[model samples]
Target: MMKYEEEYWIDYIKNNELNKKEASELLNLDIYSLMKIGDSLRSFDTGDTVSYAVSYNINYTNYCTASCPICAFYTPYKIKKYEINKPNKKGYELSLDDIKKDIEKAKALNVTEIHIVGGFNPDLSIEYYESLFKEVKKYLPDVTLKAFTIPEIDFISRTHGVSIKDLIQRLKEAGMDAHTGGGAEIFNENVRKLITTPEKISGEKWLEDAKLIHSLGIYGNSTMTYGHLENFDDIIDHMIRLRDNQIDTPGFLSFIPLKFSIENTPLYKMGKVRYPSSGDKDIKVYALARAILGKSIRNISVYWVALGKEMAQIALLSGGSDLVGTAFSEKVFGATNRKTSTSIEELNHLINEIGRIPALRDTFYNLKEYY
Candidate 1:
């Protein structure tokens, strides 16, 4: 067992790389001490610049085959096929016109990124995504298309009988600039089984796909969903795995510690999980992320939609260097019964209120404008 001393941990964070045992010890530190260490680390790694994106989230469909217990956005493709029910309750697939209208709104907002992710709808083929990506590019050629998650890509590959390399190349040809970091709930096998369904890709598969994505010259953010059915050890292990993977592949631009929203989801209704994470726990995850992956993954993103506005600000002060984005049409969090709307003005206000320099960033974390 490692000794727990604030002084020792502080010095370790500053001078040495963290092992899993050391990371677990750091997670037990008091919130204030953790925040202090995390803040210092953040300042050293990224300086005082806090970045955000003028981005729009487009959930192309909610008819999902992977009925993950952690998700409320999906309506179970089986149910959708049998009943053909309404959206937000049963299932919904947005038409090309629907996506076009959403793109129009994003254009009006001058969004730099069009973030798209959705379920593994069996009906949708590679051609569907190809056309969708092409249309999005045609309408807004300047905006970066950061689309698809590891599980989504894996499922599409298996369902459509396409190789991962071929699928990615096709998407790139159709204007997929990057990938999103969803579907990485927890890397631990037992905990993941509790939170998500078997239909979802395994943690190892997720990592493999990420490596392939990076090898293909595409970069994107990575995430770990916490606050449900996981211990400090699990969190530490997750970050370490990500750290090692970043060392190996070097494509992940940011690490996002997503606070699991339990309301309106199966995880809550099944009585397997009890409540959302407390404010302190949320902040600790941010701090721990910095301590563990601060050197490897420089950008720690504070996803405000999962953590509320105030917690988001606190996270920025602690370890987070980015405020995710202004998720214009975010529906997954909305399905969890949380308000999921924000604007560039609101994001800037939130960052300014926290006294960090707010900068508008593109999908690649390149600072486009500073305010």
Candidate 2:
């Protein structure tokens, strides 16, 4: 184990320029000391207030072409068409009407953001998204529409024969406020090849696309799906890549660590990953993220749906500053048998229980109100 003076680590945190070696050393520190340093860094950057968003998750469709081994949400197109009967079939391509209904529900609940992400279905045209965004803006003009991951954008751009630059410009015109941070399972190419399909874009491609998105004056969050096949070094490398990008583009609004949901997925059946990440590991990851990313990425969100409420609260004290979102009607995690849906009152209570002020934020981390 590498040894460093406590004051030295504190100076690095104060300077907010921890390199990979320094970060790795921090990760090896005792859990309590690590959490203390992480919490202190978080306090120095962003004060005691914890933030969340009044947002709804709209999974437009579960019919996917990628069929990644790590995903449980997607249904094979063939199985959906042949094996499943009409009334019993769980897979679906949601119609415009269904999307409109969801938006209306979100609007009625006074939601500030609408998160739209789904499986990579090749059948959906660019016009489908344009029309959907147009109608969503027409219905809820004030709500922020954070849609599509970089991989999804890459897939759609390739399928539609439009440049990604052009696609993003058109979507911006159609009212896409920002992008989500899904599809970034792990940045290490070797691990990605083992878990995700070739249909998914590479991590390098995802970062390039993110730089492009940032160049367009739109900012999006970054994410890493951990606790599956990646080791600590892989996790550190992922955070370092994100840190380097933020250093250049400075467009990432937050870094969210999504704990892998291991149930009912192909990875589970293969007996490669046996259990969900422990609370200890979850807290450590959140802390290491804060320790490494430092001030460049100000927000670290503990995905409540993935970590569950109790662990999520503990994570907030350790390093996380955001509770992700309400995640109303979320389906991706549901396919893995995890529940993240919560009421506004519940969210407020959770944050408050941890002695932090609970604030509702928009897609861009703009504080809407404190309850």
Candidate 3:
């Protein structure tokens, strides 16, 4: 254990440009002390306004070829039902009409953002996404259409014989507002290999494509999936890498510390990872995000579906300033045996209950309404 004087470390964290060694040292501070510094930093940078997005999630398909070990949502192509834990959870693909219907429902909710991501389905082509985006824009012309991860983009571009630049340009013309930071599990090569698979894009490839996307005038978020086979050093390196990238391109709007949910996933079933990370560790991860990247990525999102509503509230006080979104009809976290449903009303209540100002925002973190 490292000796830490809380006041000194807090002042140091606020005053100086933190290097990797100093960040590692700060990780050893008491969890409560870390939270104190994180909350203070949050107040200083992002203010007391806690933001949420009125958004809907559209998981176009669960059929995937990239069978990452940490994923619970993917159903690989031609996989036998009985070969998996849940036989009833077979793969299914949604047509363009089905996606339009989802958009109609989202429009009924007056959603300002439409979040779309899915598995790397080999059957879908670049034309499929083009038509899908065209149809979505035809219906919800005003809603911000944030779609696809860097891995998904890379897969679609390579498998369909389209350059990444051409793919993103075509999608932008078809109506892609932004990208999601889903496939960035972690930056450390060893830990990333342990959690994800070869089919998924490499960490280096993810960052390269992200910079390319930023150069195209497209914006996106960043995430680090922690709590599974990753040490403090891995986490610190991940943040630093993202911080450097943001400095280069100025594209990442937020950094979301995604907690690895182990239930019903390969990591859990294979005896490689037995349990979810503790609440103590979870809160500390949020604080660590604040300490490392708070200045660079001002919005640290507390994903309620992964942390549960109560724990997510605690995370808000720790370092988080965004509740992600309502996450209407989310399925990925649900596959991990976690509840993935919440309403705007419930989100507002959660923020107000914590004695913070609740505000709705769009994909770009622009404030929409204050409650």
Q: Residue-wise lDDT of candidate 1 within 32-147, one digit each (tens)?
A: 88887888889989988899888898999988888888888898898875677544456788888888899899889898999999988999989889988998999999999999
Name the regions of candidate 2 deviating beyond 4 angstroms.
1-7, 78-85
lDDT of 3: 0.88
- For each candidate, what is the lDDT? 0.89, 0.87, 0.88
Ordered by lDDT, highest first, the candidates read 1, 3, 2
What's model 3's TM-score?
0.95
- List candidate 3 segments past 4 Å from native: 1-4, 78-89
Clashing pairs in 1: none
Model 1, stretches more than 4 Å misplaced?
1-8, 85-89
lDDT of 3 by residue, 17-90 (tens): 57899888877777888888789889887999999888889999898888899999998866834555665668
Q: Candidate 2 residues 1-371, lDDT tens each?
A: 22355456766778767777777777767787777777877887789989988888889989888999999999875576675567877688888999889988988888888899998887788889998999889999998999998899999999889998899999999999999977889999999999999999999998988998889877889999999999888999999999889889878999999999999999999999999988788888988988888678989988899988999888888888998889888889999988646899999999889899999988898898999
The stretch of ten residues in a row with the least summed lDDT in candidate 1 is 1-10
User: How many clashes (backbone N, Cα, C below 3 Å) per candidate?
Assistant: 0, 0, 0
Score every model by TM-score. 0.96, 0.96, 0.95
